[model samples]
Target: MEATFVIVGGGIAGVSCAETLAFFEPDKSIILLSESSLIKTVINLHAITRTLTQFNIQEMESSEFSLKHPNITVIHDTLVEINDGEHYILTSTNKTIKYEYLCLCTGAQPKLIPQAELFEEIIGIRDTDSVEIFLQKINRAKKVAIVGNGGIASELAYKIKNTQVHWIIKDKHISATFVEPGAAEFFLSSLNKDVQEEQVTKRMRYQEEYSHRSGAALGPDWYKNLIIKGAGDLNIPSEIKIHYETEISNIQRSNNSPYALEVTLSNGDKFTCDMIISATGVTARKSFVSKNELELSNTGEIKVNEFMQTNLQNVYAAGDVCCANWKLAKHWFQMKLWTQARQMGSYAAKAMVGHLNNEEVLQDFCFEMFAHSTKLFGYKVILLGLFNGQKLGTNYEILIRMTKGLEYIKFVLEDNKLQGAVLIGDTDLEEMAENLILNQIDLSPYGDDILNPDIDIEDYFD
Candidate 1:
């Protein structure tokens, strides 16, 4: 087997790269290989700003890749070995495929804590199958212990009902991955509130049998319509007890206790729960490729330059598998999110096409600023640039405006210039805020009036 381009992985990054290449260079042949039959495809793309984008991911059949692009072929196979010297790859089924250019998008896997004996008791949610397993376990669980404070942990903290939730975090506040201390405080109020009935929105749902092979990470609204209730059928409001500045020190099954297992925390607190969820985080999946073949970061991520090319000629990597080895823009930073995966994949395709054609390629504008939109506790959340004043030390000023349960808006300013912002709820300030940060417009003349409720910020910026 042979092709002009061979892409490994069927996640958002690999799909986006293949589609972009097929569209730009229709005469060239492209092949995509995946371990699973389901592939992630982004749809309903809306560019909210130059750098901000909103999109939904659809889990499509792997065959759809070739159906959509005649120049591309999709194969359901796992890459077992890569011979970089000869530009050939060996599949698990003993098939060898040669390619002139190869883009690796194998993505990352959940970084669970080292617990070899308790693997069955600890579950890490990453894909639809993992979520299904979690739901099955929760159905019989009266209480569960959740570890980590990222997006997944935060979402589960709000979504899971009827179960006594013991949320363990190593931070001073909750949802520390996305927001600052003040925003975390604002969200803390909603933990014990009643779960309000939300209006259902029309969206496509894809169902398939769970496979042992790891699939792509679940997308936005992954828990939208899922039944997240636990076994305990209490009429009272949901209970969530947050243990800040704590982590699991030890976990083991208890023979005498009523609960299934006993967990000891680093803070010397112990609790018994029916289940334990480890959302600790993810690490790069680079074992397939030999360490002697390419250079990798200390964290085990493949190192890629500005053009997304690795040290090896004609080899590139994108998505969570690769770390940005170039000097990033002031506002742009790397987060292993779906949005960055799509952007990097598309940009990598352009770079590859340009290199093949002996043409010069420029850096993508999306890398100029960091922007992300997501839902947190039923509220629309938008993060832009250095929203939490990251890397700015203590030389930054913060202005905030909150309207009870309606909205919470915050701006991070350095030298009277907008450096970042956080908009929670329907604040309708993302576009203007993004422009202010990108253009580096000084807001000093407005003083504190920038966040004044009476002022029409959008109109003023216009």
Candidate 2:
């Protein structure tokens, strides 16, 4: 009898798993189920937009992969309950599916803040519509305030122009993930100066009065010209703003106009503002899955092993929804990254196919690499590895070479084995550096050539 395989979640994780399973088990039957339509507009409209930048955005190409396939059945419905035991599996949609193997590539959902009431005053931008609405508000208002300190916040802060940008840095610095201290400092300096001074605004960190002060010769009246809030921990030279452990309280009508509103901080501090934006970051959404079937973390992430299998036997999980093993360090990362989800789904599919053939499938061994590349205000930022303490293990030797406009850091072994690294502004050496890490090359003979800025070192990996 031919085996039937059921894959849940229609996003990158689900689709990629199906693709992989199709390649591994050509004769097996496959079925896919999802709540949202598998369309670009639906993704850009509802899901996080960063998915476009992180993975092969070309997959968004309409003609690429369809939910409908010869050996696949795509169901556009949410999963309410799941029953997987000896032979048969049932879904809440009343669709009974019997599979030799099951893959739970279900992704996560956005996190809603505890006190979402305060967001009413802010110009939120989680999607295209939100961004458009916020832009309209910015064209009219002079000042803008942003919430949270993460990559999203940093991206918004770097994009502010013309209006005053107020950055509320509850934390000490910007994204703790991608940037090293030196590069982060430089990136923060690249923001618009006039905006930070007159058009830019921010909350005071600790007892310091200049936590968000502008270095320009502008006076306090600059605050009257316009106000803006940027999301993230912004570094302005030698200043730091620490909110400690305060949260937003509430937002109310300005009493004069519908467009104006008052923002209340958790500490009872009240401020009247024209607009606010919640760069507060997103959370994982997993409401589609029945809580009783599989285990979920308090943070909304799904639990899975290295093979992407959940607590339930025969059911596997992957992507931003599942916990990831951070490679090179004793840390774990969970988020909505397309590449990670796709890879995990692929792995799960292979393992499932192995079950049918009674063959042991190879589980993933390497730690997860939480790297991303993007341009902020014309400056290019590329993260190659996780910052877990393991990246700096005593066994690994870190070599850094810095020039005026570029920076390169390579992780080498005492025995010359390439481990990992972070490369910024060095476009020419990126491919070579990546090859070294991927191939785990032995650079013993190369010696100083590993850091050489000019020659092509692609052959070293082979």
Candidate 3:
């Protein structure tokens, strides 16, 4: 089969790239190759700020998508080989695909615990099938151990009920992945509070028989439909025990013990649990091989230039499979986020279209600032550029205003200019915070009054 554009994977990046290509070049034929039957699509997107956006994710059958877009053909097949020299790829089923422009959006796989392979009972926090498998395991589990502190583990800790969660992290506090310690402290209280149970967002989910191959990594509200509970009564909230500054050092089968496995920690503590969910993180997936292959970053991801093009001619990569190799913007850095995936994918399509039309495509303005919106512990969270004071060295100062059970706001400032911000809860300051970071206006005159509760911050801006 031949197409003007051939995209790989069915995750957010691949889908976004394919859709964008179809929209721009309606007459051009596009083929999307995937291993799974379902494809993830973003819906109900609301931009909280110019750059910060929130969206609900839906996983639907790939066939449904192709029927809607007659110009785009969706092929359910795994990419196995690449021949950049001939601008073609080979799938697992021996289907030969020739393309004018090719994009590899092959997502990442879970970076499981080092000892994961030795165990027959460990589950890597992954796609719907695995998560469903996890739920089935936890259904009979009285105690569950989660081995990661990233978004997936944190969310699992909050959502799972009627079980004892031993959350092992190498960091000092919970959710070190997204927030600083101060913000972590602010959210600490809500960790156990079951005030107004989190209502699951209803969505389509495939059963265990959906397809043995794991579908794309899930996105926003992927667990909403899953009522994750343990062997205990559903009314009882899940209990979380944090073992900070520690990691799993070893795993061994219990010797006729009731619990299935015994996990030894790096700090020399041992615990028994029915199952271990390794949310350790993800490593870029690179199962397919090319004749010359593609240039990779130090982190084993495809290195893409400012235009998302790889070293190989007419080949590009995006999302978790690729890393940005260009000089990053002051406020922007790479994180393997669904939002970034969407942004990179869209920009990649623009770059490809511009290349074909011989038009100049300036860097997207979204790159000028980093923004993300998410929900944690039932609180709205918005992160804006350099939120952690990253890359600023020790020259930056932090300003914070936090109210217990209400909101927590932190600002990273350098040279009297706003650099980044972390806004937890509905502070309604994302727009102002985003503007300040982008404009880089001096806030010295306002001094500490800028965050004063009495003064309306928006009034000064107006």
> Which candidate has the top score in TM-score?
1
Off by over 4 Å in 1: 116-119, 198-213
lDDT of each: 0.85, 0.53, 0.85
Provide TM-scores for the models. 0.96, 0.69, 0.95
Please state the error at residue 38 of candidate 1 in Å. 1.8
- Can you give the lDDT of residue 326 in candidate 2? 26
* Local lDDT at 368 for model 3: 87
Residues 379-459, candidate 3, lDDT per residue (tens digit)? Answer: 777889999999999999999999898889999999999999998877888889999999999999999888888999998
**Models sorted by TM-score, best on top:** 1, 3, 2
Range of the 10 consecutive residues with the lowest summed lDDT in candidate 1: 199-208
Q: Estimate the lDDT of model 3.
A: 0.85
Scanning candidate 3 in windows of ten residues, the lowest lDDT window is: 200-209
RMSD of 3: 2.6
What stretches of model 2 exceed 4 Å from their correct place? Answer: 1-3, 39-55, 58-68, 86-98, 118-142, 160-162, 193-252, 255-259, 264-271, 288-293, 325-336, 364-371, 386-419, 431-462
Superposition error at 236 for model 3 (Å): 6.4
Number of the top lDDT candidate? 1
lDDT of 2 by residue, 336-393 (tens): 5444565677778887877778898665532434444444433454445433224445
**TM-score quality measure for candidate 3:** 0.95
